[model samples]
Target: MTDISTSDVQHLAQLSSLQLDDHEVEALRVDLGNILGYIDQLSELNTEGVEPTYQVTDLQNVWRDDVIDNYDLGRDELLALAPDADSNQIKVPKVL
Candidate 1:
């Protein structure tokens, strides 16, 4: 098991822009050491034949053909449904 010093915890807290109290610092010291020890245990596993995968779902880029439908609504009718319209186009509030 790895031992994390209080100074190491303080340095990590500083890098992460965290303000930890005395009790929190001691708690994190033990937590970080346990995390590193778990990682050390994982390193001992045999993974020589394992294939690297970016996603576990095994799905690739799926695409479909574009089809346009009028949906029984004309351009003028769609524009009229909008709360605001100008010059035969829908007017939306400016975001910027």
Candidate 2:
């Protein structure tokens, strides 16, 4: 079993930029200890000839040729449809 200390939890929280209260710190210490213990248990397994599995699903990426299509509309014609335009650019209300 792994022994996780209070300082270990505090150091982890500091590195992660998390402001944990005392109660939460205690909770996380136990949780981290349990996780490490489970990992230790897994390390005891023996598999001499087992093949390592990278991905379970036999999925492959499908690719398609890139095609560009414009609906026959000119730049100036599209700009004219906008409610507000200035210097060949559409104007929108300021955000934030």
Name the 10 consecutive residues with the lowest summed lDDT in model 1: 56-65
Which pairs clash inside model 1?
none
lDDT of every model, 2 decimals: 0.91, 0.92
Give the TM-score comparing model 1 with the true structure, all chains together.
0.47
Best by lDDT: 2
Position 19, candidate 1: lDDT? 100
Clashing pairs in 2: none
What local lDDT does model 2 show for residue 31?
Answer: 97
- The reply for model 2, stretches above 4 Å from the true place, is 14-17, 47-51, 60-96
What shift in Å separates residue 57 of candidate 1 from its native position after superposition?
Answer: 2.2
lDDT string, candidate 2, 1-96, tens digits: 589999999999999999999999999999999999888986778978999988878877766568865669889999999999999999999988
TM-score versus the correct structure, for each prediction? 0.47, 0.47
